[model samples]
Target chain A: MASEAENANQAPDEESIISDFFVPLARDWPGAYGLADDCATIAVAPGHELVIKTDPIRAGVHFFSDDSPADIAWKALAVNVSDLASKAARPVAYTLAISFPEQPSRSWLGDFTAGLSEAQEHFGCGLIGGDTDHATGPMSLAITVLGEVPIGKMVRRVTPSVGDRIFVSGTLGDAALGLRIRANMVDGKKPEQMTDHESLLVDRYLRPKPYLELRSALRAYATAAMDLSDGLGKDLGRMCRASGTGAAVYEPDIPLSDAFMAVAPESLEERRSLISSGDDYEVLCTVRADNVANFVALAASGGVVVTEIGIVRTEPGVTIIDKAGEAQDWAGRGYDHFS
Target chain B: MASEAENANQAPDEESIISDFFVPLARDWPGAYGLADDCATIAVAPGHELVIKTDPIRAGVHFFSDDSPADIAWKALAVNVSDLASKAARPVAYTLAISFPEQPSRSWLGDFTAGLSEAQEHFGCGLIGGDTDHATGPMSLAITVLGEVPIGKMVRRVTPSVGDRIFVSGTLGDAALGLRIRANMVDGKKPEQMTDHESLLVDRYLRPKPYLELRSALRAYATAAMDLSDGLGKDLGRMCRASGTGAAVYEPDIPLSDAFMAVAPESLEERRSLISSGDDYEVLCTVRADNVANFVALAASGGVVVTEIGIVRTEPGVTIIDKAGEAQDWAGRGYDHFS
Candidate 1:
């Protein structure tokens, strides 16, 4: 492969990109070795356990192939950090494996690295080590994020009890609605006709902010918790299944931004489908009734909104109640990668 | 995408595959949560530091698209473990991100997981977490391996001194020759005419054995070390560049398997080219001359052959010497992912 490519004489090799751009991003981390060595070494603090997650995003699958390289890089890192936050862990480092469809442009790489620098600083982590390669296909970004949590204190996805109040941080379904706008499939108006508030939904889809600030409150008050990437309905179903319980969620109480209500589907059926669409990246947890006030207060202090939408129950499946307190059949079950 | 696919009525969902097949592989690890949770938690030993490396291999680039799924899986794990071995670290866990070109068959998945089970047990590590996705492109397996070394003791790729004796483990060039056979590009004889010994070379190419047993000896006797994956000449050049030293390697002293000699190219020039063709996962290290005998003895006790191939020098580039004690110009550098 190298000989054939050399015969054609391509100008910069993978190594040069690592040295010129990626290495600068890694300079602050002593273990990164300026991207020279095969691996990086890191030590966890004495009282903490490492929380690890790997999530891969492909060009056409996770984001549009034409999305800005800077936004692409940010989404790649933020999604993995979202997993760490769900576990009530603080982000520390990440290893990125990126394969480009072709030799990336200098401008694109520059913007991408700039985005990565901003994210690493914002989340208090550094690039530890990674691998880069050339692909004859779409670009793929697979990130393995490492985080730290106090030993034996990380929250879990199971252990929710009957009567535990279900709460979610931040409004839901904006990303899903934003995805519709990006796909140009929004029902009524085209994206060019979108209002400023509607564009906020598009930004939410492009750049998800993992709720890291809610970690402390979740660890202190929640029994079962997870991130809302797979939509509130589907993800909550998973949490209930794991905890051996079910939930009764009020459809009118499912949080939505004013912008979402203004332009998104309005009828109960359409609204339920929109809200159940995923990529929220917010914390979804079940807290004991006694701890609800304290959890709400802590979340507010952290500058995050918390809303009670449901309560855990001994029933075997999720039940959605309309404004009239009548049960409605769900039209969708959230996003499944393969169907 | 999910709705369209669902309306089209695909055979299975991604979640079912995870719950049915992948969860079994992760059953023994409490941190894996039966592959249910979004993240895994692990506590490193107090005095140990984590060593991490991520390498991604694509179907056509790293292996043939038609290669046995089991062999592909083994190669995926072994290659990453080889990186850890080069750093003198003990393998502990790994996160896998696999993108499939199409939904794989049950038999294929079963064979692949069986190979993973074997490799994980052989290396004393467990699956922590990972991501799986469907791709419209070629299959890509990106793995991030986590290893442990005593704090402050992880081996690095630099710091070799003048007068250090360079050593390599196992025979070289067999895998490179095997690749040619696999590609049906062998100069004289077709692959169908290959002998059992020659076939062993192909197996070596398909599944590499990471030299983990030599970790203790390497930590004790070597000043600097790295794996010889991108051909000996190119990789040695990298090591020299990093350590600010040069090396004079004797061509005749470099070890080669009988299988490679039987079917590989003849003449000094042909042999040099063959030896320089990459994918030799053997360790290449520079040790103090005084410790050569002890290092060889330690390696022998561990049932590994260590060969003295060169010596580090004060000059700045690698010099390849023939049996006549004359330097020869290398026609090819190592494999570059992007040229």
Candidate 2:
């Protein structure tokens, strides 16, 4: 559900989402930013303080309605960890508010628990507590993760510096292509060609790594960082808005896995949509150009890859350049919550 | 629907909620204690930790399905605050997770937000951050409150000293009366009658006043304290179970309003039920008898009225005595989420 919601929420409906949801949240959570911005500014830990982020994913809307319960669980925890990963904070703990239907089978619950346990081990986040109730509606999951970074070290979407080199960890469109395979849109594909690659993409889409290791290093090395829950185009645009700057990325430089290129060679339009499709769950960051080599090396030592895809600019809007350095129209970048 | 759910959740056939609708949540929230506890413990501030409590108030379950949106909002925030109050923690911040059908009239949301704003101001708590999504089913309001207490000051239901005097703040059973009135069971009641004698009781039922004053006071003055949420009978039972002690409350001394007695004279059965009916939101505390007088004077100075209803016995379990100290029986006690 998260993979799907991670996409659906990015569609051009964030206006409604903001009006209906964020407006009320702003009204209720009156702080420095309110709901007008990405994260709420809260006073915590006396001198250090903290930043909080929350998002919800619904079944059918967020993931394939028939996604494995284990995968569902992984995505649920990973997505929230992803939120913390963006802030360059070490996740301290999290709370979940779950709504389930009556008489959920023990098996259903066990699979979900197993998935959560696996992620908890991987992420090192302690689940402090949350709510469980009987719901007669759709399956919905909302997890709120709390993390701590040094007060001054916390990286917000607003901190990117103009002329900063932008970077992303992991491949880009394989997850989006995975959905295409599941939908039977990729014909003439040998099962062997996709056996490992497609499955890897599918799994990544279902449970992309949260990039926790990258957070601390990013804060020290990168000027601003955010998790690519949405595709690069839309998410990068958001980064620009936060930093009050513009950006220019070469399309050919965007990271793409062999599996992704093989699956969607002829679908340039589809490829374009994938760039805005969301649910990537990798970290997209902007670092000073001088620090790019070290940034790449830090992730490399951890067996994770970081690629420089673009550069933040002092201009006030986003631009995408082709291989020939011709600016491409990037009208469609990421998903929005409301239409 | 919430009222129906409140009564019917324990019936084991509730999962019909999801199979009946197609919905989902994003799949990545980190956790070990995500789904199994009544509350989640979080390490918020270093020396001062926090207890996070989130409860969803569905129409028909937590409140009458016909309740006004304003009252519903009030009850939702009030209930979560009450949980912290039980632990004797100062209210700090809260996050609300709300899901309602799309296209809800702006006016409905306005009233709801107004109610929530009112509660926030009254409690000195700020809304931190949370989520809002669209749901096609019943209106569900999930509020998560984060409260900080000094490490040693945060009392749990599981800690009570033997020979401690059990005290309760304000009165009990009035919330139960409001439930009855809303159910149309208690009639011929006038608006003025509910003002003076029953005003405290009726208001206590609808808009429960948290014992925030009592919480800080208890840190220095109490051995163990908890809010009487479920009811006097059941809540006392829990305290006894948690503390590994016994308690005996004299029934004739149970606090009540003169109007409550005048309006429902034959409601002996009702009164007895209120003892166990839950949702009173008053404090049930245990203190060594030696310090009771000083605590009482402190409570009085804070404008909070507290009454001693029982004594913590060295034995295990609870026993209710009448005016003459004879044993008493109740049909049942309080609202249990699972039971």
Per lDDT, the best of the predicted structures is 1
Please give, for residues A82-183, the per-residue lDDT of candidate 2 as tens digits: 877766777655656666655344455556666776786788765555555556677777777667666556665656888899888888877776766755
Enumerate the candidates' DockQ scores in order: 0.72, 0.11
Task: Point out where model 2 deviates above 4 Å.
Answer: A1-51, A64-66, A179-194, A322-333, B1-47, B64-68, B183-205, B262-265, B323-326
User: Which residue runs does candidate 1 get wrong by more than 4 Å?
Assistant: A1-11, A185-194, B1-12, B185-194
Candidate 1 DockQ score?
0.72
For model 1, residues A1-339, the per-residue Cα lDDT tens digits are 556335333445787778877998888889888878888988889999899999999888889888778889899999999988878899999999999988886667778888888888888889988888888778999989999999988888887999999998889889988888878743566657878877889889989998789888988998888898877878899999887899999877888898888878667667677788888888889999999999999988888899999999999678888889998767237877765
Residues B74-113, candidate 2, lDDT per residue (tens digit)? 8888888887876767677666667665534445555566
Every prediction: chain A TM-score: 0.93, 0.80
DockQ of 2: 0.11
Model 1 C-alpha lDDT per residue in residues B1-339, reported as the tens digit of each score: 556434333444677667755777677778777777889888888799999999888987888877778888888988999989988999988888899888876667767788888888888888877877888878999988889999988888887899999899999998888877777743555556778877788888888998999998898998888888889989988888887888899888999988988978777667778788788899999899999999999988888899999999988889988888888778246788886
TM-score of each model, in listed order: 0.94, 0.79
Candidate 2 displacement at residue A295 in angstroms = 2.1
